[model samples]
Target chain A: MKKVLSGNEAFARAAYEAGVGVVSSYPGTPSTEITEHVSEYTEIYTEWATNEKVATEVAIGASLGGKRSMTCMKHVGLNVASDPIMTLSYTGVNAGMVVIVADDPNMYSSQNEQDSRHYARFGKIPMFEPCDSSEAKQFTKDAFALSEEFCTPFYIRSCTRVSHTQTVVDLVDRVEGPAFAPENNIPKWVMIPVNARRRHKLVEHRTELLTELAEGDKYNKVTMRDKSVGVVCAGVAYNYVREVNPEASTLKLDMVWPLPIEKIRKFSESVDKLYVIEELDPFFETEIKAAGIKVEKLERSLCGELSVDAVRALFNGEEYEVESDNSLPFRPPNMCPGCSHRGMFYAINRLKLFVTGDIGCYTLGLLPPLQAINTTVCMGASIGMGHGLDKAAEGMSEKAVAVIGDSTFLHTGINSLINTVYNKGNSTVIILDNGITGMTGHQPNAGTGCDIHGGNTPKIDYVNLIKSIGVKPDNIRVVDPFDVTACMETLKEETAKKEPSVIITNKPCIFADRTVIDAPYFIKEDKCSGCKICTRLGCPAILWDGEKRVAFIDETLCTGCHLCIKVCKFGAIEQRSK
Target chain B: MKLDILMVGVGGQGTVLSSNIVCDVALANGFDVKKSEIHGMAQRGGSVVTHIRVDEEVFSPTIPAKSADIVVSFERMEFLRYADYYGDNTTLILNTQVIAPPSVGDGSAEYTDDKVEEVKKQFSKVYATDAISKAIELGNPKIAGMIILGILAKAVHFKKEAWEQAIKDRVPPKTIDLNMKAFDLGYNI
Candidate 1:
């Protein structure tokens, strides 16, 4: 049967059809849907691990137990899981294992635009890149088989364009992989120094065999069209090339890593001119050049995504003029109308605290109006960075604070908290407990009291977790983030303390819990004072009438959480009658 | 023959769902379809766009610059945002509604009425309507996107039955009637 599917969805369907027994992942954009879809198949045991490292370890454990296993995560998540993947390359898997890493070439929902192909090369594993959803399914199934054949873990690299794009895919029945009996080969499974040294030799041998396999037409294809111009591309870039220059000779690499060196050289020789086209990094171009092959080095921006227009412009020797109007107002992503993080960030901004922010929805706090967050390096870096900032700067103890989301706190902030306590750091850490992973479409985490399958699970108590890690019970305070005054007072009290403090802002994300939204708020024109205090909250629902010099709420956009009402000192803003 | 439809709107204006319906209509009409849109941060009240291609054979999910056969926008400002995507032959179906961004709210930017005039002067074939108000008259403001899709349906050569079937397949069963009414309201406009 043929069905429309995104690249992420295709990967999930392919994994199920390939009879994958175990699937694990942490939610991240462009890749989160893979595991979410995998959970629908009852035959597969799926989970939302606390972080990518844990997810990778779980899949690794399942692979070692003689079952085909898969783990999916975004490009940055691969960094956290890389420790295991780099070593797992040396210690080959017992069963077929595939790591699906979706790269955000344009940094769409990612902190960095690092290419996952580099990871495949760094870990010495074969990587496959699919152009569209159809290829995504076929490559995933082929990747699993190749992994088992080579006795190594394989990488399937997807970008935002491919993963988020939907196209037709052909579905097939479940073809269960060959089952393996558990074996206790210490030298093969264990990665101690002496054993790892021997396993390293096997890794090199596997690479050679994979390179030869890549050289064949199975993984790499050469389209002999007009030999005047040749294009070497992979993943979504191939689609753009095909869209614009279909008449040109093309060398599309389905297997990006372990690139067929001889095949590339032959393709270059076949055409009059060879052009390497790929998004972000010039991995293929650099490698082809290093192989001593002469290819045209086109000057293109290494930033953002490559599009059909970009390819046309490249061949025409002109720039792709992005259709954009500068006069149009910039519409940056903002906090929702009744966002739970609003009041807390409002208080933090009032306090003038130097906040070390972590990844999540709260990262938006760094933008305009309520610029509360000072630094956002990565997941769970807020606590450690805050602690380090306080230790380095003498007078920054009271001014420094760390803000993290509940899901992210559970992911890695807990480790940073333990380090902070052990090192006697005096920084205050605030956990924005919105009950769900608010950023990547609200996936359940360890603290959310739910599993990937929507089954109930024990919720992690932040207070007890913090206390057990040496923080005093009195130092941990739970406050309602929606209540602006209470949030402000609690923050002020915690930052003044010399000891390490943990503040938990308890409120469900408005999108997660619509029950919190009441009647929409409106402003009484008679009682209005045009002080713009409510506007400082930067609520998307609140707009200022410059002519009237008063603020009015857009009832359509308002969630009616009464946050703006609290900020309005004058008796102007009132809840609309239901 | 290839048809490229570019849908632009605010994040929550249902561009994704509308584009999905367009793809479904194309599929029901026996055409190959590919659709592409960015998710995540762009979903939070930011500018969102979807590129959809329907043809005998579709290569790139994204439409080439200035080659969009039809451009449907859910808001006035958003319609003007992608001026580069419009060619002389491009037909524009725009919703006459304005959702001011934070910059406009803060007085850092101006969203003037001149934008609507600019859109009228630039595009040769323009179909502009208050779809939001019409949707609200139909009992729900959210169906404005459906109304825009209805206008889009008239621009294409597909049969009305294909659009109805696509809508029925895409929407919830309970609200199918309301959505169909909204679509018809747009179709007649």
Candidate 2:
């Protein structure tokens, strides 16, 4: 059957058809849907791991137990999983294992556009890049088979364009491979110095064999049209090239790693002039050049995504101007109308505390008019960075606060908080427990009392977790983030403390259950002061009428969490009568 | 025989759903369709866009610059936001609703009529309407996108039955009648 499927969805369908027994992942943009889709197939055991590292190890464990396993995460999540991936490459898998890493070229919902192809090369694993959803399914299924054949883990690199785009995919039936019993080969499974040294040579031999396989027409292909100009590209870039310059001969490399040196050299020789086209990094370009191929080096911006227009402009020797009106107001992503984080951010903004923020929806607090967060490095960097700031700068402990979400705090912030208590640091750590993973479309985490399948799971209690980590019971305070008054008072008391404090902002994301929605709020024009104090909350529902110099709520957009009512000292904002 | 449709709207304005309906309609008519949109942060009240191409064979999921056959704007400013994607031959189906961004609300930026005026002057085949008001009149403001898709259907060559079937296939069974009514309201407009 043929169906419309996004790349991530296709990957899941392919895994199902490939009879994948285990699927594990931590939700991240462009890649979260893969595991989410995988969960629909009851035959597969799916999980939302604490972080990418844990997810990768889970898949690794499943593979060692003689089952085809897969783990999917965004490019940055691969950084956390890289530790296991690098070593797993040495200690080959018992069953087929595939790691799907989706790269965000334009940093769309991501911190950096770090290419995942490098990880495939860094980990000495074969990698495949699919251009569209159809290819995504085919390549993913092929990846599993190739993994088992080579006795190594394989990488399937997807970008935002491919993963998020929906295209027609032809489906197939499940072809379950014969299950192998769990083996007890210590030298093959374990990675000690002696075993690893022997495994290293096997890894090299596998690479050579993979390179030979990549040279064939199976993964890499050459299309000869007008031989005047040819482009060597892969993934989404190949689609742009095909769209803009269809007449040009093309060398589309489905397998990005292992070089495909002979195929690339032959393709280059076939065309009059060959040019390398790719987004972000020039991995293919640099490698093609180093292989003694006479490919032209085109100047392309290493930032952002490559578009069809960009390819046309590159060939025409013209700059692709982004057609945008500067006069138009910018619409940056903001907190929702009744976001639970707003009250906490409003209080933090009022306190003017130096906040070390972590990843998730709370990162939006860095935007005005709240601008509460000061530093955001990675997943759980806030706690560690805040503690480091306190230790390095005198008197900073009293002013520094680390803000993290419940999902992220469980991911890596738990260890950082333990470090704070162990080192006797007085850094204030505020855990924004929104009950669900808010950023990546509300995937359930360890703190959430649900599994990937929405089945009942033991929820991790933050209060007990913090106390067990050496924080005093009195120092751990849980407050409702929607209550601005309580949030402010708690933050004031917590930030001023000379001991390590853990503040848990207990509120479910408004989107999680839509519980924040109530009667719409409105402003009484007569009682309103034009002070714009409610506007400082930066809620999308609140609008500032410059002419009237008064603030009013957009009833259509308002969720009536009564946050603005508390912010309004004049009692101008009131909920409508239901 | 390739048609490139660009749908632009605010994050929660149902642009993704409308584009999916367009894809379904195209597919029902035996055409290959590829649709692309960025999710995540862009979904949080930010300007969102979806590029959809329907043809016998679609290569890139994204429409090339200046080649969008039809531009569906769910909000006025968003039409101007993606001005680079359309040209003189493009037919624009615009929803005359203004959503103020945070910058506009905080008085850091001005939301002016000049942007809408610029869009009107640039495109000769512009079909502007208050779809949001029409949707509200139809009993739910959220069905505004179906109205815009109805206008979009007039610009494209798909059969009316194809659109109706596509809508029925995609929407919830209980709200299918309401959505179909909204689509007809747009088609009549």
User: lDDT for every model?
Assistant: 0.89, 0.89
- Candidate 1, which segments miss by more than 4 Å at Cα? A320-323
Local accuracy of candidate 2 as per-residue lDDT tens digits, A1-578: 87888999999998999999999999999899999999999889999999999999999999988899999999999999999999999998888999999999889899888988888888899999999999999999999989999999999999999999999988989888559788689999888999999999999999999999998867788889999998899999998898888899998899998889888888888899999999988898888888888978566888888888888888887887666677778898888888889999999899888899999888999999999988888999999999999989998978879999999988888889999999999999999888899888988888889898778999998888888899989889999887888988988888788899999987788877675679999999989889989999999999988888888889989987888888889988888998
- Which tens-of-lDDT digit does each residue in A320-340 have in candidate 1? 656556776888888888999
What TM value does the first chain of each candidate achieve?
0.98, 0.98
Off by over 4 Å in 2: A321-323
* Alpha-carbon shift of residue A99 in model 1 (angstroms): 0.7
> Each candidate's TM vs. the true structure?
0.98, 0.98
